[model samples]
Target: MTINDIAARAGVSISAVSFALNGRKGVSDQTRARVLQVADEMGWAPSSAARSLAEAKTETFGLVLARDPHNLGVESFYMRFFAGLELEMSIRGYGLLLQVVPSVEAELAKLAKWRNSRSVDGIILVDLHVEDPRVALATQPGALPTVVVGDPSLAGGLTSVWTDDAESMRSAVRYLADLGHRRIARVAGLAALAHTSIRDAAFADETRALGIHGELVRTDYTPQQGAECTRAALTGAEPPTALIYDNDVMAMAGLTVAHELGLDVPGDLSMIAWDDSVLCEHTLPSLTALSHDVVAFGSHVARRLFAVVDGAEPGAFLDSTPSLRVRGSTGPLRG
Candidate 1:
């Protein structure tokens, strides 16, 4: 039911019902209780849109992501990340307005709505690219308080929450290298993504530092493309003895390819995946992966955004560095 129904049931003015439903001041405590009781009895709820109009802030943080929302089901990283974000939001009595946009253009338009309409107090951005438009828009004074999830370069004047992909990548690579792996290759996600570039650079640097040859194959973040890239890598005359994947989905797909090629994992080739997920632990042979609290990572960004919403300094929160968690997906290289 709607607010009007609740007001009628409670024999109160629509404004009174509105204030009560929002836990806003103006109505007496007893009147608020009466309105709430009527709302509960009638199964009525106030509209977030209405609340946005009444109160300048929506009491929500907008999360703008460029990935397929449906992919969230299989990606365990998001599960933890969202939980952490929610944990912080819940404690602060704020809510999350999550939206999946098709492109950066659409995302910007959506953010504009939230800003002009005051539908959110602040925003958290994910999937940054080099010279992204979001960075440019966020630089404007008195724009929506923003926190970016990746790459400080694109963060511009906005607050950022980043992971130490360079150090973590070096550690993961060194883990395999120390295990005697050589001729390494990496399965990279969308080349345009900032994190992909970071991992690519780190992988190349670590390999060169260790004096081993390294190569990278870029693909969209999909299992099918991962399988195709895996086949190409495994079928080469001089195949790499180990592969480091940017995400667990691709690593699982690569593992399937390895089985098809009759190459025993770690016996013939080693594998290490970044951003540990449940798939890493459940996969046959269990992937050796660079693991970190990515969910906590996301939550940290959310809290920083909340701080900005509360009038904290802009661009005050900055980088995060992810640590390594070793598992079974990698092993010593064998000729």
Candidate 2:
């Protein structure tokens, strides 16, 4: 229904109805409440196009993933994260525009187009790189309000939401070392991502400090690559007594590779996975993992982007440090 009907039923002028409906100042609170109630009873709904035109806002946010879309189907982390984002955005009467591109260049192009076309009010950037061009683009004068989901250092002055991945990596390595694993290997994700680099350094430093022989193999965070890396590491001469995987899918794959090679869980090999999920709990041996509230982390990022959209200064927010959850998949290293 129209505001004219609401004004007539509420016994208020059309200007007063306009003020109350649009949250402008020219109406009393009691009158505004009455007008709103009457509008609701009359089945009044604001036209999205008109509202957007009046406010000069699209009321939408954007996110671009520069990775294989197939990986998102099996990766529980992104699913939970998206759920959290949707939760926050829906409550705020906002929409999310998501794009999955095969390369960083394509992702940048999409972001540029969104900004130029005014398709979204803000942006949430993920999978940050060490020398990310996106950071520069987001920092340009008159750029859209952007929040980076990565370490503060990688954000380049943009508002950022991050977990302590480096510290978590060190904790995982120390836990394995404490269990008498002198030879350890980590099946890492892509080498270019900023968090991956941070984790790699932490793994190397922690293992060296503990006098452990640490090996690292990089993959694309896919099950196929994970399986391949696992087979190669497990079949090498003097195989590691313990292994750490960057994500749960990789760890699960490694477990299968261990079984194929006649290795026993925590008996001949111990393992740890990052970003724990239901799959980790249901695995035959129940994987030990680095666990954090990924859904909450995503919600926190959305909140920061909203704050930035509301004219807040750029800053960093630390979500959490992933803690280790021990399970049947990891234990004292056996002889």
Candidate 3:
């Protein structure tokens, strides 16, 4: 079906249908609604190529997932965060062009393709590394507007939306210290991620100040790696009295590993998770977590991206700080 059919069904001129469909100012609100209803009912879909040319817009945003899709597995935090971003995009009559790539170079190539093809109005970047080249790419003269979903330090001069991860890490350490956990081990995520660096530095600072013995083991945010690291830490000559994990899945795996060692959670060992999900509560003895609304964080990022697309000044914006949630998985260190 075509706009001609929609115009006929809505009892309006072809130009009127065009105005309504393109969100132009020529049509009244009632007429626009009638045109859209008639078009939807008639199964009239515009050609993407034709629509882009006519409206000078794709009405889409771009996002690249920088990792092997199979290796990444199911992550509740990202799923929820993506849903939140979709919510905002849908309300604004936009779509997200998602692509998963195997490496940082591949992700950058995807962004470049989108920019060159005019497939997106702007891009949202994730998993920033130290001295991220993406920041340099987007900050160059006449570069595409970008919103970085990481700490402001990684964004260079581009717009950024982030939580206070350093502060949050400090809080987690202090919470365990208060429970008399002197030797604490952290199950950290990929070292390349800018957040991991922030958290690692914070962990070091806090442990040093509080006179706590701390060990950090890095992983690819996989449950298997989480389990492996947990077992190694607990079976060491000098085991940690408490443990902190980068995410809920890893934390749950750590719990199981503790059991495999015939240890009691919050009795022989204490554990904390960085992100809260249903998994945290469902685990035996539950998991103490540093909690924040990830969905809301995604929404905040979307809003910032929209502002950038609208030619707003690029700057850093801090989202909600994560709060410590006490649970049965943590307790006073036993003698």
For model 3, how does the per-residue alpha-carbon lDDT over 117-146 read when each residue is reduced to its tens digit?
A: 667777898889999988888887546668
> TM-score for all predictions?
0.81, 0.85, 0.85
lDDT per residue as tens, model 2, 1-335: 44545667898765577778778897999999999899788776578324433333467899999988777787788879988888888887888888999999999999999877768878999999997999999999758889999999999999999999989999999988888999999999999999999999999999999888999999999989889998998898888989999999999999999999999998999999998988999998999999999888888988998877665778999998899999999998666
Highest lDDT: give the candidate number: 2
Off by over 4 Å in 1: 1-56, 68-72, 315-320
State the weakest 10-residue window (summed lDDT) of model 2.
Answer: 48-57
Give the TM-score comparing model 3 with the true structure, all chains together. Answer: 0.85
Tens digits of per-residue lDDT, candidate 1, 34-144, equal 988877777553464364334434678888877766665655676688788988888868788988877788898988787677678778887889988877877775467
Clashing pairs in 3: none
* TM-score, structure 1 vs. true: 0.81
Model 3 CA deviation exceeding 4 Å by range: 1-23, 26-56
> Candidate 3 clash total?
0
